[model samples]
Target: MGLIFLGIGIAGTILPVLPGGPFYLVAAFCFTKSSERLDNWFKGTKVYDKYVEGFRQKRGMTRKEKIRINLIADFFIVLSLFIVDILFVQIIMVVLGLYKHYYFIKKIKTIKPGEIE
Candidate 1:
Protein backbone atom coordinates (compact mmCIF):
# COMPACT_ATOMS: atom_id res chain seq x y z
CA MET A 1 0.00 0.00 0.00
CA GLY A 2 2.77 2.39 0.92
CA LEU A 3 4.73 1.59 -2.20
CA ILE A 4 1.61 2.04 -4.26
CA PHE A 5 1.07 5.48 -2.84
CA LEU A 6 4.71 6.40 -3.31
CA GLY A 7 4.56 5.26 -6.92
CA ILE A 8 1.44 7.29 -7.52
CA GLY A 9 3.05 10.29 -5.91
CA ILE A 10 6.12 10.00 -8.08
CA ALA A 11 3.98 9.60 -11.16
CA GLY A 12 1.94 12.59 -10.07
CA THR A 13 5.11 14.63 -9.86
CA ILE A 14 5.69 13.97 -13.54
CA LEU A 15 2.05 14.23 -14.59
CA PRO A 16 0.49 17.65 -14.10
CA VAL A 17 -3.04 16.26 -13.73
CA LEU A 18 -2.47 14.22 -10.56
CA PRO A 19 -1.74 15.46 -7.07
CA GLY A 20 1.67 14.59 -5.60
CA GLY A 21 1.91 15.85 -2.05
CA PRO A 22 -1.15 14.08 -0.75
CA PHE A 23 -0.04 10.77 -2.17
CA TYR A 24 3.44 11.11 -0.71
CA LEU A 25 2.02 12.11 2.60
CA VAL A 26 -0.29 9.11 2.68
CA ALA A 27 2.60 6.84 1.77
CA ALA A 28 4.73 8.28 4.52
CA PHE A 29 2.01 7.81 7.06
CA CYS A 30 1.43 4.24 5.98
CA PHE A 31 5.12 3.47 6.09
CA THR A 32 5.35 4.91 9.56
CA LYS A 33 2.59 2.64 10.67
CA SER A 34 3.74 -0.55 8.90
CA SER A 35 7.53 -0.47 8.87
CA GLU A 36 10.06 1.48 10.85
CA ARG A 37 12.80 0.93 8.33
CA LEU A 38 10.68 2.19 5.47
CA ASP A 39 9.71 5.22 7.49
CA ASN A 40 13.35 5.95 8.24
CA TRP A 41 14.29 5.54 4.60
CA PHE A 42 11.55 7.90 3.51
CA LYS A 43 12.57 10.43 6.14
CA GLY A 44 16.13 10.28 4.87
CA THR A 45 15.13 10.90 1.24
CA LYS A 46 16.29 14.32 0.10
CA VAL A 47 13.41 14.84 -2.26
CA TYR A 48 10.76 14.03 0.33
CA ASP A 49 12.57 14.66 3.60
CA LYS A 50 11.69 18.31 3.87
CA TYR A 51 8.02 17.75 3.04
CA VAL A 52 7.68 15.07 5.68
CA GLU A 53 9.56 17.23 8.13
CA GLY A 54 7.46 20.26 7.34
CA PHE A 55 4.29 18.30 7.90
CA ARG A 56 5.58 16.71 11.07
CA GLN A 57 6.85 20.02 12.38
CA LYS A 58 3.63 21.74 11.40
CA ARG A 59 5.62 24.23 9.41
CA GLY A 60 4.34 25.99 6.33
CA MET A 61 5.96 26.96 3.06
CA THR A 62 7.47 30.40 2.46
CA ARG A 63 5.49 33.05 0.65
CA LYS A 64 7.54 32.55 -2.48
CA GLU A 65 6.93 28.82 -2.47
CA LYS A 66 3.21 29.34 -2.06
CA ILE A 67 3.12 31.76 -4.97
CA ARG A 68 5.10 29.44 -7.21
CA ILE A 69 2.86 26.47 -6.43
CA ASN A 70 -0.26 28.48 -7.01
CA LEU A 71 1.04 29.74 -10.32
CA ILE A 72 1.99 26.29 -11.54
CA ALA A 73 -1.31 24.78 -10.48
CA ASP A 74 -3.22 27.60 -12.09
CA PHE A 75 -1.30 27.18 -15.30
CA PHE A 76 -1.94 23.46 -15.51
CA ILE A 77 -5.57 23.80 -14.54
CA VAL A 78 -6.19 26.49 -17.12
CA LEU A 79 -4.35 24.61 -19.80
CA SER A 80 -6.27 21.42 -19.19
CA LEU A 81 -9.56 23.20 -19.08
CA PHE A 82 -8.82 25.06 -22.29
CA ILE A 83 -7.91 21.92 -24.15
CA VAL A 84 -11.12 20.15 -23.21
CA ASP A 85 -14.05 20.68 -25.60
CA ILE A 86 -16.84 20.40 -23.04
CA LEU A 87 -17.91 23.88 -22.02
CA PHE A 88 -19.95 23.24 -18.88
CA VAL A 89 -17.62 20.63 -17.47
CA GLN A 90 -14.65 22.78 -18.35
CA ILE A 91 -16.11 25.73 -16.48
CA ILE A 92 -16.82 23.57 -13.46
CA MET A 93 -13.31 22.18 -13.51
CA VAL A 94 -11.84 25.66 -13.77
CA VAL A 95 -13.74 26.83 -10.73
CA LEU A 96 -12.81 23.74 -8.75
CA GLY A 97 -9.19 23.91 -9.80
CA LEU A 98 -8.91 27.56 -8.82
CA TYR A 99 -10.62 26.77 -5.56
CA LYS A 100 -8.12 24.01 -4.84
CA HIS A 101 -5.23 26.34 -5.61
CA TYR A 102 -6.62 29.06 -3.39
CA TYR A 103 -7.24 26.58 -0.62
CA PHE A 104 -3.67 25.37 -0.64
CA ILE A 105 -2.24 28.87 -0.87
CA LYS A 106 -4.27 30.03 2.09
CA LYS A 107 -3.46 26.93 4.12
CA ILE A 108 0.25 27.01 3.32
CA LYS A 109 0.60 30.74 3.92
CA THR A 110 -0.16 30.21 7.58
CA ILE A 111 3.26 28.69 8.07
CA LYS A 112 6.50 30.32 6.96
CA PRO A 113 9.82 28.59 6.54
CA GLY A 114 11.37 27.59 9.87
CA GLU A 115 8.22 28.56 11.69
CA ILE A 116 7.37 25.13 13.08
CA GLU A 117 4.68 24.54 15.58
Candidate 2:
Protein backbone atom coordinates (compact mmCIF):
# COMPACT_ATOMS: atom_id res chain seq x y z
CA MET A 1 0.00 0.00 0.00
CA GLY A 2 2.76 2.44 0.91
CA LEU A 3 4.78 1.48 -2.10
CA ILE A 4 1.78 2.05 -4.32
CA PHE A 5 1.36 5.57 -3.00
CA LEU A 6 5.07 6.25 -3.37
CA GLY A 7 5.08 5.00 -6.92
CA ILE A 8 2.10 7.12 -7.86
CA GLY A 9 3.72 10.08 -6.15
CA ILE A 10 7.00 9.69 -7.99
CA ALA A 11 5.09 9.48 -11.23
CA GLY A 12 2.93 12.42 -10.29
CA THR A 13 5.96 14.60 -9.65
CA ILE A 14 7.02 14.18 -13.25
CA LEU A 15 3.55 14.20 -14.79
CA PRO A 16 2.20 17.55 -13.54
CA VAL A 17 -1.36 16.26 -13.96
CA LEU A 18 -1.42 15.02 -10.36
CA PRO A 19 -0.45 16.70 -7.09
CA GLY A 20 2.80 15.01 -6.13
CA GLY A 21 3.75 16.32 -2.72
CA PRO A 22 0.67 15.19 -0.86
CA PHE A 23 0.86 11.68 -2.18
CA TYR A 24 4.55 11.42 -1.46
CA LEU A 25 4.00 12.75 2.03
CA VAL A 26 1.27 10.20 2.54
CA ALA A 27 3.62 7.47 1.41
CA ALA A 28 6.28 8.70 3.80
CA PHE A 29 3.75 8.57 6.58
CA CYS A 30 2.66 5.03 5.73
CA PHE A 31 6.27 3.97 5.70
CA THR A 32 6.82 5.65 9.04
CA LYS A 33 4.07 3.47 10.50
CA SER A 34 5.09 0.29 8.72
CA SER A 35 8.85 0.25 8.14
CA GLU A 36 11.57 2.31 9.74
CA ARG A 37 14.05 1.44 7.05
CA LEU A 38 11.74 2.69 4.32
CA ASP A 39 11.04 5.89 6.18
CA ASN A 40 14.73 6.62 6.65
CA TRP A 41 15.39 5.87 3.00
CA PHE A 42 12.66 8.30 2.01
CA LYS A 43 14.12 10.90 4.36
CA GLY A 44 17.42 10.66 2.54
CA THR A 45 15.86 11.43 -0.82
CA LYS A 46 15.88 14.89 -2.43
CA VAL A 47 12.11 14.72 -2.81
CA TYR A 48 11.75 14.44 0.96
CA ASP A 49 13.86 17.58 1.43
CA LYS A 50 11.88 19.47 -1.19
CA TYR A 51 8.40 18.48 -0.04
CA VAL A 52 8.00 16.90 3.36
CA GLU A 53 10.78 17.61 5.85
CA GLY A 54 10.01 21.26 6.51
CA PHE A 55 6.37 20.62 7.32
CA ARG A 56 7.38 17.56 9.30
CA GLN A 57 9.75 19.80 11.28
CA LYS A 58 7.05 22.44 11.88
CA ARG A 59 8.67 24.91 9.49
CA GLY A 60 6.49 25.19 6.43
CA MET A 61 7.02 26.45 2.93
CA THR A 62 8.17 29.99 2.25
CA ARG A 63 5.35 32.39 1.35
CA LYS A 64 6.57 32.23 -2.23
CA GLU A 65 6.19 28.48 -2.20
CA LYS A 66 2.73 28.71 -0.71
CA ILE A 67 1.74 31.10 -3.43
CA ARG A 68 3.19 28.87 -6.09
CA ILE A 69 1.28 25.84 -4.83
CA ASN A 70 -2.00 27.72 -4.55
CA LEU A 71 -1.59 29.24 -7.95
CA ILE A 72 -0.99 25.87 -9.51
CA ALA A 73 -4.01 24.47 -7.74
CA ASP A 74 -6.08 27.40 -8.92
CA PHE A 75 -4.95 26.86 -12.46
CA PHE A 76 -6.02 23.24 -12.36
CA ILE A 77 -9.30 24.05 -10.71
CA VAL A 78 -10.15 26.68 -13.29
CA LEU A 79 -9.20 24.32 -16.07
CA SER A 80 -11.44 21.66 -14.60
CA LEU A 81 -14.30 24.13 -14.76
CA PHE A 82 -14.26 23.62 -18.51
CA ILE A 83 -14.81 19.89 -18.17
CA VAL A 84 -16.93 19.71 -15.02
CA ASP A 85 -19.60 22.33 -15.47
CA ILE A 86 -21.72 21.60 -12.42
CA LEU A 87 -22.16 24.79 -10.47
CA PHE A 88 -21.87 23.00 -7.16
CA VAL A 89 -18.62 21.38 -8.23
CA GLN A 90 -17.15 24.71 -9.28
CA ILE A 91 -18.12 26.20 -5.96
CA ILE A 92 -16.48 23.31 -4.18
CA MET A 93 -13.24 23.85 -6.06
CA VAL A 94 -13.23 27.51 -5.18
CA VAL A 95 -13.89 26.64 -1.56
CA LEU A 96 -11.06 24.16 -1.60
CA GLY A 97 -8.75 26.92 -2.80
CA LEU A 98 -9.92 29.22 -0.06
CA TYR A 99 -9.38 26.54 2.55
CA LYS A 100 -5.91 25.81 1.21
CA HIS A 101 -4.91 29.44 1.43
CA TYR A 102 -6.34 29.60 4.90
CA TYR A 103 -4.42 26.52 5.94
CA PHE A 104 -1.13 27.99 4.73
CA ILE A 105 -1.81 31.28 6.48
CA LYS A 106 -3.17 30.06 9.78
CA LYS A 107 -1.77 26.60 10.33
CA ILE A 108 1.65 26.26 8.76
CA LYS A 109 4.54 28.32 10.06
CA THR A 110 6.09 30.42 7.33
CA ILE A 111 9.79 29.86 6.86
CA LYS A 112 12.69 31.15 4.88
CA PRO A 113 14.00 28.77 2.27
CA GLY A 114 17.14 26.90 3.32
CA GLU A 115 16.93 28.22 6.88
CA ILE A 116 17.01 25.31 9.27
CA GLU A 117 15.00 25.38 12.43
Candidate 3:
Protein backbone atom coordinates (compact mmCIF):
# COMPACT_ATOMS: atom_id res chain seq x y z
CA MET A 1 0.00 0.00 0.00
CA GLY A 2 2.67 2.45 1.03
CA LEU A 3 4.83 1.38 -1.88
CA ILE A 4 1.93 1.96 -4.25
CA PHE A 5 1.37 5.53 -3.06
CA LEU A 6 5.11 6.05 -3.13
CA GLY A 7 5.19 4.96 -6.78
CA ILE A 8 2.25 7.21 -7.70
CA GLY A 9 3.89 10.12 -5.91
CA ILE A 10 7.12 9.59 -7.80
CA ALA A 11 5.19 9.39 -11.04
CA GLY A 12 3.19 12.47 -10.06
CA THR A 13 6.40 14.44 -9.86
CA ILE A 14 6.73 13.99 -13.61
CA LEU A 15 3.07 13.86 -14.61
CA PRO A 16 1.13 17.11 -14.47
CA VAL A 17 -2.22 15.34 -14.08
CA LEU A 18 -1.28 13.97 -10.67
CA PRO A 19 -0.48 16.06 -7.59
CA GLY A 20 2.89 14.87 -6.37
CA GLY A 21 3.30 16.54 -3.02
CA PRO A 22 0.15 15.18 -1.45
CA PHE A 23 0.83 11.73 -2.78
CA TYR A 24 4.36 11.82 -1.39
CA LEU A 25 3.10 12.95 1.96
CA VAL A 26 0.59 10.13 2.04
CA ALA A 27 3.28 7.68 1.03
CA ALA A 28 5.60 8.95 3.72
CA PHE A 29 2.90 8.69 6.34
CA CYS A 30 2.06 5.20 5.21
CA PHE A 31 5.68 4.16 5.16
CA THR A 32 6.18 5.30 8.73
CA LYS A 33 3.57 2.80 9.85
CA SER A 34 5.44 -0.12 8.32
CA SER A 35 9.18 0.23 7.87
CA GLU A 36 11.56 2.89 9.13
CA ARG A 37 13.91 1.79 6.39
CA LEU A 38 11.36 2.62 3.72
CA ASP A 39 10.67 6.03 5.18
CA ASN A 40 14.36 6.84 5.51
CA TRP A 41 15.00 5.63 1.98
CA PHE A 42 12.33 7.93 0.65
CA LYS A 43 13.67 10.84 2.63
CA GLY A 44 17.03 10.24 1.08
CA THR A 45 15.56 10.23 -2.41
CA LYS A 46 15.42 13.22 -4.73
CA VAL A 47 11.65 12.91 -4.82
CA TYR A 48 11.51 13.79 -1.13
CA ASP A 49 13.63 16.88 -1.67
CA LYS A 50 11.55 17.88 -4.68
CA TYR A 51 8.13 17.33 -3.17
CA VAL A 52 8.06 16.95 0.61
CA GLU A 53 11.21 18.17 2.36
CA GLY A 54 10.35 21.84 2.73
CA PHE A 55 6.81 21.18 3.87
CA ARG A 56 7.98 18.46 6.24
CA GLN A 57 10.41 20.94 7.74
CA LYS A 58 7.65 23.51 8.18
CA ARG A 59 9.31 25.84 5.67
CA GLY A 60 6.35 25.66 3.24
CA MET A 61 6.46 26.01 -0.55
CA THR A 62 6.86 28.77 -3.11
CA ARG A 63 3.74 30.84 -3.73
CA LYS A 64 3.46 29.48 -7.25
CA GLU A 65 3.75 25.90 -6.04
CA LYS A 66 1.08 26.48 -3.46
CA ILE A 67 -1.25 27.93 -6.05
CA ARG A 68 -0.68 25.04 -8.38
CA ILE A 69 -1.32 22.49 -5.63
CA ASN A 70 -4.45 24.26 -4.40
CA LEU A 71 -5.87 24.52 -7.90
CA ILE A 72 -5.17 20.86 -8.56
CA ALA A 73 -6.92 19.90 -5.32
CA ASP A 74 -9.87 22.11 -6.27
CA PHE A 75 -10.06 20.55 -9.71
CA PHE A 76 -10.31 17.09 -8.16
CA ILE A 77 -12.98 18.25 -5.75
CA VAL A 78 -15.08 19.67 -8.55
CA LEU A 79 -14.53 16.50 -10.55
CA SER A 80 -15.80 14.53 -7.55
CA LEU A 81 -18.97 16.57 -7.53
CA PHE A 82 -19.82 14.99 -10.83
CA ILE A 83 -18.54 11.50 -9.95
CA VAL A 84 -20.41 11.35 -6.66
CA ASP A 85 -24.18 11.55 -6.50
CA ILE A 86 -24.81 12.21 -2.81
CA LEU A 87 -25.53 15.85 -2.03
CA PHE A 88 -23.93 15.56 1.39
CA VAL A 89 -20.78 14.06 -0.05
CA GLN A 90 -20.69 16.75 -2.71
CA ILE A 91 -21.12 19.45 -0.07
CA ILE A 92 -18.36 17.95 2.02
CA MET A 93 -16.07 17.83 -0.96
CA VAL A 94 -16.79 21.48 -1.76
CA VAL A 95 -16.05 22.48 1.79
CA LEU A 96 -12.84 20.53 1.70
CA GLY A 97 -11.85 22.25 -1.52
CA LEU A 98 -12.43 25.69 -0.04
CA TYR A 99 -10.59 24.67 3.09
CA LYS A 100 -7.66 23.49 0.98
CA HIS A 101 -7.10 26.99 -0.41
CA TYR A 102 -7.75 28.59 2.94
CA TYR A 103 -5.22 26.38 4.69
CA PHE A 104 -2.54 27.00 2.12
CA ILE A 105 -3.07 30.77 2.04
CA LYS A 106 -3.57 31.35 5.74
CA LYS A 107 -1.76 28.60 7.60
CA ILE A 108 1.47 28.25 5.66
CA LYS A 109 4.52 30.42 5.16
CA THR A 110 5.77 30.39 1.59
CA ILE A 111 9.39 30.15 0.50
CA LYS A 112 11.05 29.37 -2.78
CA PRO A 113 12.97 26.11 -2.98
CA GLY A 114 16.46 27.50 -3.40
CA GLU A 115 16.30 31.23 -2.75
CA ILE A 116 19.11 32.54 -0.61
CA GLU A 117 17.10 35.52 0.48
What does the lDDT come to for candidate 2?
Answer: 0.76
Candidates by TM-score, descending order:
1, 2, 3
Error of 2 at 64 (Å): 1.2
Q: Write the per-residue lDDT of candidate 1 for residues 1-117, one digit (tens) a residue.
A: 989999998886654556577788899889999999998888788747755566556756677666775677668777878788999878777777766677676655566565637
What is the lDDT for 7 in model 2? 89
Quote model 3's TM-score: 0.63
The prediction achieving the highest lDDT against the true structure is: 2
In angstroms, give how far residue 65 of model 1 lies from its true place: 1.5
Give the clashing residue pairs of candidate 3, or none: none
Question: lDDT of all predictions, in order shown?
Answer: 0.73, 0.76, 0.75
Shift of residue 19 alpha carbon in model 1, Å: 3.6
Tens digits of per-residue lDDT for model 3, 1-117: 788998898776554345567788888888888899988897898878877777787567788889887766666667768888999878777776676677678877888767753
Stretches of candidate 2 off by over 4 Å are 1-26, 44-46, 114-116
Least well predicted 10-residue stretch by lDDT in candidate 3: 12-21
